[model samples]
Target: MLKHVQVRSSSSLLRPGGQKADTLSINSNMSFCSLHEPALSSRSSSYTSLNETQSSTGSASVPAAPPTTTVKVYTRCLRPDLEYKTMSVKYTTTCRDLVDQLLNKYRMKHRDPNLFFLTMEVATRSTGTAVRTILVLDDDSCPAQLQACYPRADSKFTVRMRHGGLVKVYDSVLMAESQYKSLLVSDRTSVDQLVQLLLTCYKSNESVHNYSLYEVCRTTSFERKLHADDRPLAIQQEWSSLAEYSFVLMKRPPGTPRSGRDFPLRRSFLQWSRNRELASWSGREISVIEERRSKSHRSPSLSLAPARKEGEKSFYI
Candidate 1:
């Protein structure tokens, strides 16, 4: 009788620790020795394929960072002195974005973004005179792109408060003689609001209604009182190119109309009076007068009073 047998070789099978065993089995019709070898190779290939797929998928999902640029921003509106700050921003950063960054850097994040803007100052020498032209950039405009437009001129970027312009506010009552405050204003800000702001800045307990804002032009020697509903910023912008304008805050004159016809003479008189008062009370004169007054007030009748020096005289004599 013919008998059928099966044989298996342990050398081709993966043992518990992936070691080859010294055992064999024989099969007459088929060979089972390489059966486990294919299974192990297939599993390894599938695992390698899975790891590659995972790596490719992870690399494809992540995004690359955009390019950045460095810019210098001059900030003159935040303080009396000019300041410049350097920042790292994206090339596509807009004027509005730069303004926000500047405000945040200066610890003024709580302020309104609309109150500030970016400007480009182009300084050129024309007709042997130095001329400067300031152009206000739109909020959507890109600062980095605009800077590239002017390659030869001395151009600089500055952050300014969105005002008609910088106006000098003279408050003779609150401030010292010939001293004034610089204020930034918007075109829509009215005289009443400006007066209130000035009062708040000076920390005065006076009523806003009692004060009036006057526009004084030194070049034209003209003066006018601004109405409550009048926009001082707009007026300033209009007269900006024509003359040097300043704002004067003072008490509202009684029985006087808002025409401001006689205000100039009144202002002059007030200035003269102030000058006279200042001239009459000089530092040396004040000290001498104070000394005489102190001596006259001292009691000469006191027996404990020390005798006067050789050159000194008693107030009673």
Candidate 2:
């Protein structure tokens, strides 16, 4: 919604000094002071002679500058369910003045004056990076009145989502980790979420030490017991397992050996289940599927395109 902030002298408390005077008075004493002798028509020539004997002088005072009132104007959609968020907001000149007026209007009327920290942030748009001045205010202060004062303030002073840009995050979570426990496959993913995912992890046992930003944007995996789905493991590269901060994660179920990407197998693994009844009657659900690539010592140009257009069918899932 379009917000309004008005700047007028008589209606609001002006910008520190822009207050207007209700009346004006000319100095009447100037007429009788005899500082300058009145012109003599027929009767006033006597006054010129009196001033030469007068010992004191009086001066006229210059009028003070009028006080200006500014109000700040801004817009926000209230999402009451959100917790404290480190979101970006912008203020125009109108909004800044509004905030300034609001700050002054809502200061302390109690036994103790309200204390707050004023901090500002700017909009990051192609319009060019502008700096914002933060004017902290007391809780439940009357922002409406503040906006009422500086109606003509600039919109550049405040920030908005359109002005800044989208923010991104990477992390992992268990589907039922909310309800159960399971293995730690690579856990990384992004939510169209705010700085909240971080808070959620912080509040729970889910840790970030295991998270990593990768070649792709992000990678995430939930536990099997909490297995939201049974897709093959993500394309885990050799480096994924050998990173300096390698996690001693449990191997995936042999029945669900992760596929895709270039990976190697060292120790042999068997399909085994923790459940006794299920372990007794199983055979390898394994199948052979070969991937052909360019022979080594071949130039990249030749290796880039495979020797064959494609391969025959492996198996139908």
Candidate 3:
């Protein structure tokens, strides 16, 4: 959607007594000032005469550069369920303006205007490195208009609620033990936040202090575990990039051996299941007999084989 902001007039003229004349006035939505051209021409002539006088008197007047409204930015909400909103904002638009617009478009029941904050999720041009989420300070202008923040591409901004003692987080995906959980986390949530969220979701008797978060990334051959760090944005970025992001709870550091007793029970159970499945299979199983019968019928027989080829000897095995 396109939204236009009105610009103040910059056209001024010089008066007869070495004073400035009234500034030119334009309508709010005026594409061009349609005032009498003759009046404008007279004002320009007077302004130019004053400039000539200034140059002859060894003083020069420098015209002020007109303010620009060239920047138009597109912003999207991080909320998956909400319809994505793309707005064209002026370069002079403040962060507060964008935040208000976002809130108005998607009303948040618990969001406090005073506590609202905006953050940007940034990624490098290359896929080798992970994305970074940086806080958008309210006092700062919109990063979308700044070339330094996003040099080659546009970034999505996320809304966060911050109270004196509490933080409102964005939507995040967390997986554990073959179960998927979508939860909201506090801004800049660390390992503690993950553990707390897990404890609440699972209703586990274990204390949060006793738990440690270990990230698990899987490959075709095997799974690798990395120690979860305290960086919230880093973790959020990793979660956003992955199709399936999960963390496991381990009593010890990853790669440590499990208790011997548990392993025997698990192994015996798996073996028993395998044996039971094999025993349940019928001898007439189509896959097993079909290929075998095909091979047997195709076997070359000494007596039934074709007669010896011309100039070739026939052998019996």
Candidate 4:
């Protein structure tokens, strides 16, 4: 009887060193050797015509299996390597200079979504989530607030219609009710514009409008936690500040009487009144009501915050 030796290509097999060769089995019906140990295999074949076959096909050649992929599944602050408790939510400051104040205040990355979410949920340990209250920021009032909030760019304060609710975006001097009763804007709406408007109220020559980013985030988070209404959804320009923008997260103006509008806002407002909504973002609500005076009450506005330094504008983004 001719003995056939089996060999494994790699020496790192799970079996112990000397024990591998002892467990090798032999079958006379098959001439092909099975791998139990590679370190001991010697080329000792003095047999009939060699035959190589796979169960699928008795082919002369067979290919090795392909390697598996190793993509890292991304998750929150918890590092798989170590252990820690909770992490505060983070929100990205505007691509503006004021963002630097926030960025420095909390060490975060501009591109990190986890860190960004952490920023949005910060310091909301107390208070009502739906902050209907508003702040009025006059030109002089805004300048002081801007200096206090962002002392780095203490001298710069400008307003643009980029961020805020529909009212904030259209609150442009051109769209001012004092200038015109109502103006139509076909441009797409976004929550980034909503937050930008709040910054404006924080700084200005005339009273500016303002509030906390957490409120907006909470409004958004609430929608995520609850479903929108069954009413036919439509974007109506003339409704309350919340209903004006199509985005699901913009804050509803305080003390403003509610009216039937679209799906999410109407539904969210209902949830808010019932206290069914999560109030985790109440602390994020800051006052801009004092800033709502003068021409600021006219909604569909923009931000009164200063523009970014040319190079810095692109940096935060």
Candidate 5:
């Protein structure tokens, strides 16, 4: 049976340690040898294929980088000419990014980047009647998101010097009677600088010398005034204090003597008459009548007057 089982041997498989066993198995059964040869070859091919597949998978595992996006924006300087500027930035670019770019570009052209910042006036309503100027904060979102707040696409913006602050709406007689000037002052501006701003409206020659910032409060229609310390950004507290605030610019007449307090209690004829009438309605009212005369009275005369009857006329003897 071994003589009849003639097997072809491969020199590569005929190693000194392994050929004898292979030959013996082949010689034992010819049909079994044929099936075993294919199995051995298939095992080697499958191993090589697995190694190639692993290498291919290893190279493919590194993820590809995601793409970036950019957007274009336009800016206008709030000036006589309304100078225009254009910029292209990333989708996630912020106010700081645009401001820095603008500063650099402006410096290149005009050679001055100091105090300039990006700003835009956003309309408060759909009818485009009123608008508020908002300083583009560093952390604020991109122009696309800002458009949602502003709503008007054609609305222009400005790159101006930081020079103003927000003042709260107060319902005082002075504020109601006078034209409401929205004072937007820079945080770095001094009280003296604010006095200069007030001078523009009042246009008094003595404004620079006499005008000063005051802490003015009116409780029950009695106006109380205090001299505010002169400092840079003195009214910073009032700058953001939307409601609870009492600050005013008062222009004292030239050579007019001021007491310990800036605004003294001296009633005019009308104010005195009004006070008298109001006191009569209250039945019994103690009144401090401050009578002041120019040069005649060195100081105001303060006298406490007892409540009089409706028909009584008192004499100062």
Candidate 6:
């Protein structure tokens, strides 16, 4: 006789003190600005004239325009084909203005500018160890100024989609074979809701109960089976790097026990969710299974191999 397995909904989870998850809050008032290129030639001429006048008379020269920095912003959530865009930004450039420039560069139209936001990846040294962390920048925050503060540390900027919050989801069984799909969600959006959205995107008619979502880190070989009541977007925001870790959709192993006792409260995440501080999950290291090489490539010496092997897997599932 087969024993039936019980399933729990996302709403059943409780907070630290036994409270419900917070309501969804989406920011739809993000304003768009037109791109305005600074006239460098005119500024140079003005500076040259000021230097001549200063030489002729012992008068003080005026300060030049704010210095600008060249930066590249990558975006896989908006359009996968278009990887990144480069532009010049001054110390006063805000995150909102950066998004406007990217949209203009891509010539994207009819899309709500409110659904996009910027995130930065910073690598800092602590106790002689390198630590990388991702930060979701605010509309009023200045990326150029922030980079200047961390001149010694490595910094990278990426434009991500976020209404409530945008999360990248993978549908493959292996990391090498996975391709990401972006979904808009909030802290209130449960794992169950994410599964439904993925189902609709993939056009799968399978039972939602038969599936499970796992947070997998390919670099560390660490994976955690997320609870049905878990908020995926909130979990993603707590991660260190999107490239090293991601949410993967997989089939639930048969007869796997289900319970909410092991899951943390969604409200607890609010304490460190969007803060500027760094957060990383520490899990026991696990061993990875290496793929076997063919006889022709058995030798451990260098050889002129094709860019992609004949049997290599595709990026998409």
Q: Considering every candidate listed, which one attains the maximal lDDT?
A: 1
Which wins on TM-score, candidate 3 or candidate 4? 3
Model 2: per-residue lDDT, tens digit, 1-317?
A: 12244443344334457774443334332223344434433235456545644532322344545444332333221122432223122222233333334334444121011112122233323558654445544334433334444433422123222112212222233232333222222222121111123434345443333322222211222111112122112222322332221221222334553333221222101111112222332343111111122335432221222233255321211
- CA-RMSD of model 1: 23.8
Residues 44-134 of candidate 6: C-alpha lDDT, one tens digit per residue: 6899999998886764455668999977788777679878767799989999888877766766532335568898999988999989999
Model 2 alpha-carbon miss at residue 156, Å: 6.6
Query: Model 3 compared with the native: what TM-score?
Result: 0.26
Q: Please tell me which predicted candidate would have the highest TM-score against the true structure.
A: 1
**Model 1 local distance difference test score:** 0.66
lDDT of 5: 0.47
lDDT of each: 0.66, 0.28, 0.47, 0.29, 0.47, 0.66
Q: What is the lDDT of candidate 6?
A: 0.66
Candidate 5 lDDT over 96-188, as tens digits, reads 567667656655322123245555555554575665556564436565455545445544455656554544222222334764445555555
Model 4 misplaced regions, further than 4 Å: 1-100, 103-115, 118-168, 173-317
lDDT of 4 by residue, 1-317 (tens): 23556643544445554543334344444334347534324433312123222434655347754332211111223233433222222222232333233334344322212112111111222465622222323322322223334323212222222221223232334223432112222233223333333333434333212211111122223222212222212223322455433322223356532233333352333333223222332432213322553447653222322333464321100
TM-score of each: 0.37, 0.18, 0.26, 0.15, 0.28, 0.33
Candidate 5: pairs in clash:
163-186, 164-184, 164-185, 164-186, 165-184, 165-185
lDDT at 98, model 2: 39
Model 1 per-residue lDDT tens digits across residues 19-66: 876676665664345455676678779999999999999999999776
Q: Which stretches of candidate 6 lie over 4 Å from their true place?
A: 1-63, 164-317
Candidate 2's C-alpha runs over 4 A off are 1-73, 77-156, 162-202, 205-207, 213-304, 307-317
Better model by lDDT, 1 or 3? Answer: 1
Pairs of colliding residues, candidate 6:
none
lDDT of 3 at 316: 10
